[model samples]
Target: MLVPRQVDPPETPAKTRVLFTLVFLGSGGIERSVCNVLAGLNPGRFATKMFFHHRPHPKSQQDRIPQHTEVVWGTDAFVYHRKMLPRFFWRLIQEARQADVIVAGQEGRAALLACLAGKLLGKPVVGMIHFDWGAFSREQPRRQLWGLRLLYPRMRRIVACGHDSAKAFQALVPVRPEQLEVIPNFVDGDKVRVAGEAPLPDWAVPIYQKPVVIAVGRLENQKAFDVLIRSHSLLRASGLDHHLLILGEGSLQAELEALVKSLGVESSVFMPGFTPNPHALMRRAAAFALSSRFEGLPMVLLEALALGCPVVSTDCPSGPAELLEHGRHGVMVPMEDPKALADALGRIMDDEAYRQDLSQRAHRRSEELSADRALRAWESLLSTV
Candidate 1:
C-alpha cells in the first residue's frame, strides 16, 4: 500500500506549494536528509509533495513524510536511460504545474529534469547539491557537465549542503555566485539522543566486550571503505585489538569483503549492511570514523556528534574540516592514508581521557546544526521563492 498524506490545502492564494523531485529514495544520506526536511517544514504556510522517478526498494531505508504531503511515482527506468528521461520530464512538468516552487532533491539528472520542467512551466526551481561538486566533476561525464552548465543558471537558487560546497560549486559549475546558498545538513538531535541510548542489537553484543570502531556510509568508491578497511587492519596488526563495524550497503560490498579476508582482518571487521538504526551502535562504539574522500556535509558525522560519539574522520574536501572545526571538535586525518587513519583511531580508542573530552566537545558542538536552526534557514530560503 502507498503511504497516505494529508489532503491538499483548500485552494487559496496564501498556500505556497513546494514540490520535491528525485530519482528515488534509497539508503543514503541525501534521501534521509530530504525526508527530515520534508517532515520538519511547517505545513501552515507550505503545501508539500514528493515525486519519485522510480520505486523505492523494499530493503531501502524509509523515513516518515509529512502527514499530508502527497507522494507521486513516475517511470521506473534508470534515470539516465534516454527513454526514461522524457517520461520523467513529462511527469515533472505535470507536477510542476501545481507547484509554486520545485526543490530538486539532488543534483545531476534530477536537477536537470527539474530545471527543464521549471523553465518550460515558468516555475522557480531550487537545486540541492549534496556532494563536493569540484571533486565530483572528475568522474562526471562531459555531456552531463555541459547540461548542468546550461540548466543550473536557470535555477532560482542552488542549495549547497556545506559552506565549502557552495564555494566549490561556484568554482566548478557555471552557476552565478548570487544563485548559491549554503545550508548545512541538519540533525534531529532529540531523536539521535534517544536512539543512542536504545539497546544494542544482538550481533553488536560482542563488540561491547572489546573496543569497537564504527563507520557508516554507502559502500561506494566515494566513501573509500577500502581505505577504512586497510586502516582497521593496520590497527589490528599493531595490537589495537578493536573491532571495526561498518554499516550501509552499496556496490562495493563484495570487494570490501574480499579485501577484509585478504588482509586477514575478517574476524575483526564486520560489514553489516544497512542497519535500520545506527545511532544505537554509534553510542555503544569506541569511536565513529568517516573515511570519505569528499562530501557535501555528511549527516552521519553530525549524527555521531549529536550522540556524543568521538569521531575520527578524514580531512577530506568540503565537509569534514568544517564540521570538525579544523580539528577542534574531532580528530581529522589525511584522506586515503591508512597509517594516519590508524593513528587517529588508535588515539580515540586508547586514550579514554582524550576520547571523553572529544565526546563532550562534540556533543556541545552539535547545537550548531540543531534542527531548529536549520529549519529556520530553510524556511527563510523557501519563503522568498
Candidate 2:
C-alpha cells in the first residue's frame, strides 16, 4: 500500500522587526513611552527590540519592558562621549542589521546614532521629538542642532508627541511637512485605573489624609517643581488648606527641597521621590497639577486624566493645553506664574461641583487618547515603514 503524499504547511508571514534606540532607560516620559509601545504593540504584527546607549540606573523602569522583546544595553555612562561614539555606532549597526525598521526612541544622541545606523544599513529610521523643539533647540549645544539639521531629514518619519511639538520642529528643522507625524503620547487607561486603585504606602497615608494637590514629574528645571512649591505656599497663605505632593526623583531634588524650606511650606509640602505607583496618590488627591515650563506630551498629565483626577496644569508649550483641550477638560494657568497656579489649585480644591465637572470631562478626554487608538496608529506607521 502507498503512503499518503506528504503536504507542506502554509508559511506564516514574518512580523516587522522594529529596533528602538534610546540614550538611556531613565524614569522619564520618553522612557515610559518606549516601554508602553513595546508592551502595547501587536505581537503578531510586530517584533520589538530595544537598544539603550547606557545601562539603566537603579531607579530606571527597566522592569516594565515586555519579556518577548530583546533589550540591549551598550554603556554605563550617563552621556556618551565623542571618543566612545565610534564603538556605540558599531554596536548599533550590528543591532540595526537585524531590524526591518529603526526607531530613534528619542531625539539627540539616540537619534544621531539611529540615523547613522539606518543610513549604513539602508533601513528606514523613524525619529521621535519628545519635547518642545524650539525650547529644546535653545537648550542644546550647537553641535546637537547641527546633527539634527544634517540627519533628521534622512528619517523616514519624525514623530512629535503633540501638534505644537510638530510645529516647533518645522520651525527649527527644515524637514518636509509630510515627514512629520503628530502622534500624542497615550497611556493604558485600564492599567492606569488599576494602578490608581492600589493602596497607598504607610508613609504616604498621612500625606493623603489632608486634601492634597499632586504633581508627578522629575525634580528637574523643565518640570518647574519650584514654581509648584511657591504656588502651594501662596494657596496656603490665601487660606486654602491642602497638602502639596510632588513625586519623582532627579538632580534638582536638593534645590527644590531648599525652595520648599525657604518658603516655609515644607510642613505642608512633601517630596517623595520616585514612587512606582503615583497613580494611587493621583487617584485620591483633590487635584493633580502640572507646572511644567514645557513638554511634548506629558505622560503624567495623561495618567492623571485617565484616573479622573481633577487637573490644573500650566498652559505650557505643546502638551498641557492640548491635553486639557484649552481649558475645556481641566484648568490651564500661565507657565511659572505661582499666583495663577495657586488660584487654579484653590478653585479645584474649594469648589466641589466644579472639581466634579472637571473630573467627568477628564475621564471623557482620556478615552479619546486611549492606548488602543495610539497602538493602532503605531501599527499603521510600522507596517508602512
Question: Model 2: how far is 379 from its true place, Å?
Answer: 1.3
Give all TM-scores, in the order shown: 0.93, 0.94
Q: In candidate 2, which residue pairs get closer than 3 Å at backbone N, Cα or C atoms, i.e. clash?
A: none
Best candidate according to lDDT: 2
lDDT of each: 0.86, 0.88
lDDT of 2 by residue, 310-376 (tens): 9999888898888888998998989879999998889888899999999999999998886777788
Deviation from native of the Cα of residue 163 in model 1, angstroms:
1.0
Off by over 4 Å in 1: 1-13, 76-82
Worst 10 residues of 1 by lDDT: 56-65
